[model samples]
Target: MSHLPAVTLNNGVAIPQVGFGVFQIPDAETQATVSTALEIGYRSIDTAAVYGNETGVGRAVAASGLLRDELFVTTKLWITDLGRTSARDALHASLDRLALDRVDLYLIHWPAPATDAYLEAWQGLEELYAEGLTRAIGVSNFLPEHLDRVVALGGTVPAVNQIELHPALRNRETAAAGAAHGVATEAWSPLAQGGALLAEAPVVAAARAHGVTPAQVVLRWHLQQGHIVIPKSATPSRIAANLDVFGFELTAAESAAIDALDRDGRIGPHPATFHG
Candidate 1:
């Protein structure tokens, strides 16, 4: 293949390796950002009901004139919608908002392990998966303890587990658990916010050698490690750069050089501590 290769999920679903993520994208800007992304060869579009941009995302994707089957759209259920009935309703509502028959993948926005309802909520996910409302079901920000409960409830092994992953905070232990359980790890923040990683001597050298931007080198590192990454950008230039990671390969040493940057730096909220 000339570009990034999709990884087969536990259920044999082929998820695009490099997808566009719309986490902090505002509802007003989603259409333009997504339209730009689709025009740049991005087939996978990731959004969440919690992101409040689902409607805009759907609008842009629908307006793109791409066949629904040709595009892979993924969304998540908010923690508030964690009950069986609520989760099921959330699935349909998400579909309606996204203007799709069924999402390629659906995920629980967060485990919210503190609640008494996660196990109760899982049944809803299972039901939706069975009904094909969601092509696959998974959880995000779930730790090993949470995964144990999910398995104990006789829940379907998640096809994917979206988590905060970057050069820092690699989540090595969690990655092993996911692999042992046949769940794939998807990186939400593959690029750290700080310019530090891109400015590092090693990364700069690698980018120079490949004649690409530092961001491409960082994304290239994520790919070589067998991690699925969704790096987001609204600017046309960065959006195009994020998608141009297919042509080059990173050497083992180059990959390791980036790996050395891992210091367990976590920039986002810890799911365990998040109140919502």
Candidate 2:
């Protein structure tokens, strides 16, 4: 059985704290990689329509031989599908691609404020949740301003706000805002796209001190902070190593050391102006 801990959403659905992400994995490699993750005890899997690998993800899930309820699959609505009618239709298409009747979580991929349609798109998500197309609904890459507007616009308070978060890019304000509104914060790019961030002094030191890999140290830091993290890897050893993080602990000073590494070090697009 998977030993990963679970966090309950506002809507009462429990999601695994650590998940596998399929952001840039090629469509050809997605099925095998995702199957590896599932075998390694990852219950949550994060993907998106724009990633162009939903079909591969579906194939892997179909072949896993696990029950439908055993997995928590999450996908997003791309910027192009931001209207009530289009967003609703897009979800049906994503469901078709995923080969599932309903997804565990479906989110507005980006605020795409330039289009001025996220609010309308959120309405679409509400309709999807009510119609039972998804078990839970949320948003991604949303800042406080965007989240506040969603709350003010009035509907189901988003159950989650997936954002770009890592030790080098703490994003405390957005995380705090989500907490203020009872929205669970999920971390994407949780390891800062790997490589450079993992080799940093603090991360390396923590790994040495804890007898773990630098990636595990970083992921453990995210877990200790109560943020859901989805770290992706195609290598079998790395994928298995990422899940071996639950056995250790970091002290308050050690956690703070990593937290202090935030240098506005966001490697992804900024939420305020990124429309795509």
Candidate 3:
């Protein structure tokens, strides 16, 4: 059995706190990579239609021999596929690619304020949730204002707000907003792609002190802070090590040092302006 702790969503669907992400991995390689993650005890898989790898993810899931109930799969609706009817059709296409009848969680990939269609897309998600097409629905890369607007619509509150959160970019405001509305905060690039952030003094010191890698230290910090993290890696060792963070705990001082590293370092597009 997977030992990773579960984070209950606002709708009470349980998601693994440390899930596997298939962001940049090519479609041709996703099946083997995701299969490795599954073999390593990762029960959660995060994918997107734009990733162009849902078919590979589906292949891996089919070959794993693990029961469907043993896995938690998540996918997103691309900006171009916004709107009530289109969103439903988009999810249908995604389900066809994933070879599943329904996804565990479906998210609006971006606010795309330029299109102003996220609200309508959210309406579609509500319909999907009601129809059992997805167990839960949420958004990604949403700012505080966008989240507020979604909540104001008086539909189902988002179950999660997946964002680019790392030691360099805490995204405290958005996270706090989600918390106030009972939406769970999920960190996408939790390690900041592992360059300077991993080499920083605090991260290195914590790693040395705990006999873990800097990546593990950072993942542990995120877990202790109660943020669900989906860290992606193609290397077998790193993929396995990423999920091996539960064995150690970081001291308050260590966590605080990482917290102080936040410098508004956003690595992705601002949700306010991004159209796609």
Candidate 4:
């Protein structure tokens, strides 16, 4: 029973069980934070063009002296760059900023339902993927309708869907849909950005039983549910703690107990009406 198993992608690529997220790390601090993560056995690092820290992330990787193939790097094409030409250019720019020859994964940041350009944007991703510039491509914050259209129209079925999720907001439909379509479930904001749930009775009880922090309990739940989680923390201790979840395993009763915590509690914006 391996705790950290490799999740095979639709294209047969293997991603680590957990990765570090760089959602809000300031540009200047991104390097130090990512360097700390890498040094702590984090082989995968997730970034996006909107994050404004590709340069710092790239610098951290360069300084780490790790082989390029040993790392799993992901970056997204911003919503503003959804068109064909602009999206292609954005990929190149991200590669330049990260100083990587190619990204392991790329995603369309959002469907941007108002414009309905995700189809074309996804086409751009397919072109990039076929050219070997991107190992796999997917979407983030996409609804079922968006996924249906993308898959029906010859677009890639998305290797992963990084959505706003945590114990309090599980997005069951999306997860089920992902499984139905051979897409992996990826939970972003695994901590709900540090929500009150961490102190709630159920999580606290489970944490006390396991002798781990509530945050660790919640992250462990995500892993047990077969999700690829990217938990972010600016502090090195928190970052390290988020990764120290492998030693404990949650039982069926505990898993259901935490699943009961879901009360439609979504920390991020609703994807249905989100503008970007």
Candidate 3 at residue 242, lDDT?
A: 96
By how many angstroms RMSD does model 2 differ from the true structure? Answer: 1.0
Candidate 2: misplaced stretches above 4 Å? none
Candidate 1 Cα misplacement greater than 4 A, ranges: 1-4
> Which stretches of model 3 miss by more than 4 angstroms?
none
C-alpha lDDT score of every prediction, in listed order: 0.87, 0.92, 0.95, 0.89
The local lDDT score (0 to 100) that residue 274 gets in candidate 2 is 91
The collision pairs in model 3 are: none
By summed lDDT, the worst window of 10 consecutive residues in model 1 runs over 1-10
Q: Compared with the true structure, what per-residue lDDT tens digits does model 4 show for residues 1-276?
A: 123466889999888879999998998999999999999888889999999999999999999998988899999988889987788999999999999989999998888888778788888888999999999999999888888888898656899988888888889998888888898888888988546889888899999999999999999999988999999998889889999998989989999999998988997888778776
Error of 2 at 110 (Å): 0.5
For lDDT, the strongest prediction is 3
For residues 178-245, write the lDDT of model 2, one tens digit per residue: 99999999999999964888888888898999899999999999999999989898999999998889
lDDT, candidate 1, equals: 0.87
Residue 214 in candidate 4 has what lDDT?
Answer: 93
* TM accuracy, model 4: 0.97
RMSD of each: 1.5, 1.0, 0.8, 1.6
Clashing pairs in 4: none
